[model samples]
Target chain A: MIIGEQKPFEEIWEMVKGHKQLTVFGCNTCVAVCHQGGNKEAEIMASLLRMRATQEGLEIDIKNGGIERQCEHPFFESAKALLDQSEAVLSLACGIGVQFVAEKYMNTPVYPALNTTFLGDVKQDGFFTEKCQACGDCVLGVTGGVCPVSRCCKRLFNGPCGGSSNGKCEISKDIDCAWQLVVDRLQALGKMDDYEKLVPIKDWSKDRAGGPRSFKLEDF
Target chain B: MAIDAEKIEQPKSPEKVRDVPADWKANIIAFACHYCAFAAADLAGVMRLSYPSNVKVVRLPCTGKLDQIYLLRAFERGVDGVFAAG
Candidate 1:
């Protein structure tokens, strides 16, 4: 899922300070799964804002609201009434959700409350580790299900670098050498021969080098 | 991206856990590797050497197997401090 973390409260307050009416919008999807942006988080943020405004003698009308998913137009329709009543929206969603709201509501200023971190898997409750870079290529079959491109600090394809010591990366003791893991998995799976074959250079055009990407369905 | 006013409140301070009593002992988790730290701990016990009663020792195959998540979870679970011994 897309993982993100809430920006500091001070930064969020600065964005909505001038607006008389503001809505703390939450997206109950990917960001919610990461525990960063959700209904409960939106309410907490609204409460914090209210406390701050009251302490500073600022007259601000802040409302807490959430939608199932902010990236879809139909889902945003549920928030139309709340959005119409607000001068600005403080979106507690990932970057994509914030941009989608801004595009749909051109008149109202939309601000992001979270920094979109990465595409990752929740290893455990409140713990996430990155697993992909969206390089538009798949090599997991030969690599024994480990992603050297993303897991390897140096993105080395051929083999483990000389810097790997005691099966750990030179960058840090906490980091496992990605190539070492790949070779171990391959050996255990009886696919050691795959490691002997040198991997070819990746094509840059297939990745971000081509700029923003899109997909279309012929059936649609 | 820009601050409109200089009067914004500073970020809230981190929530403080309840303070321990004056006589409360510290809770420390020691991740001891089976090869060395665990053996040493065992030897210390055999020799009848006294150590802090509050220290909890966990034996692992190797200290390298210890993940950062384990340390974080320990703190979340109210462990005051932790150290990995290899």
Candidate 2:
């Protein structure tokens, strides 16, 4: 899921304090899982903003609202009234959701309440780790389900780099060497033979190198 | 019966704004766990022990059930400080 972190309160206040009527909108999907930008979080943010406004002697009217998914148009129907009445919107969604809201409400100023972090997985309760870079090409099948592109600091294709030491990356002891995980998984699965085969150079064009990309389903 | 939104009373603006008055007191919110802190508070009450009058105690099922939004809401409602006791 796309992970995001809320911006600092001071910075967020600086951005939206000028607006008299504001809406703190949240996306209850990926960001919600992280306990950052969900509707519950949006309520907290709105409350904080209200407190700050009271302290600053500002008479701002702020409301909190959210939807299941901000990136999709259908989910926004429920929030249409709240959003339409907003003079400015503080979007607590990923960058995509913020842009989507901004695009939909062209006249109203939309501000991002979160810093879009990365495509990651919930490693544990209240813990998340990056799992994919969305390089547009997947190589997980041959790599024992471990992604070398994102996990490996060097993105080495064939095997562990010389810097790999005791399953840890050379950069940090906290980071697990991606190749080491792949090798260990392969050994456990008795597929070590596949590791010996040489992998060709990855096509850079398939990734961000190709520039802004899009996908469409013809059947739809 | 239907209610009228226009009849809702508006909040009065703060007279001091950002300035703190000499008579101002810290309003603290304490989230006490049912099994631990709440029990301790109950014992303290039974023993006639005194705590700060400003510290309002909110009993929770467990400290683990305390959410961040609760603390934020406490502050938003103009509480000076808040803590969870488990």
Off by over 4 Å in 2: B1-65, B81-86
For every candidate, what is the interface RMSD in angstroms?
10.0, 10.8
DockQ value of candidate 1: 0.04
lDDT of 1 at A64: 88
Cα-based lDDT at residue A192, candidate 1: 98
Q: Choose the strongest candidate by DockQ.
A: 2
Q: What tens digits encode model 1's per-residue C-alpha lDDT throughout A1-220?
A: 8999888788898899998998999999899999889876887788778767765778999888999888888897877889888799999989999999999888999999999989899999999988898888878989999998889999989999899999999999988999999999999999999999988998867789999888799999
> Could you give the fnat of all candidates in order?
0.05, 0.50
What docking grade does candidate 2 earn? acceptable
- Kindly provide the TM-score of model 1 when superposed on the true structure, using C-alpha atoms: 0.72
Residues A1-220, candidate 2: write the lDDT tens digits.
9989887777798999999999999899999999999999999899888987987889999999999999999999999999999999999999999999999999999999999989999999899999999998999999999999999998888998889999999999999999999999999999999899888999979899999889999999
Per-model TM-score (chain A alone): 0.96, 0.98
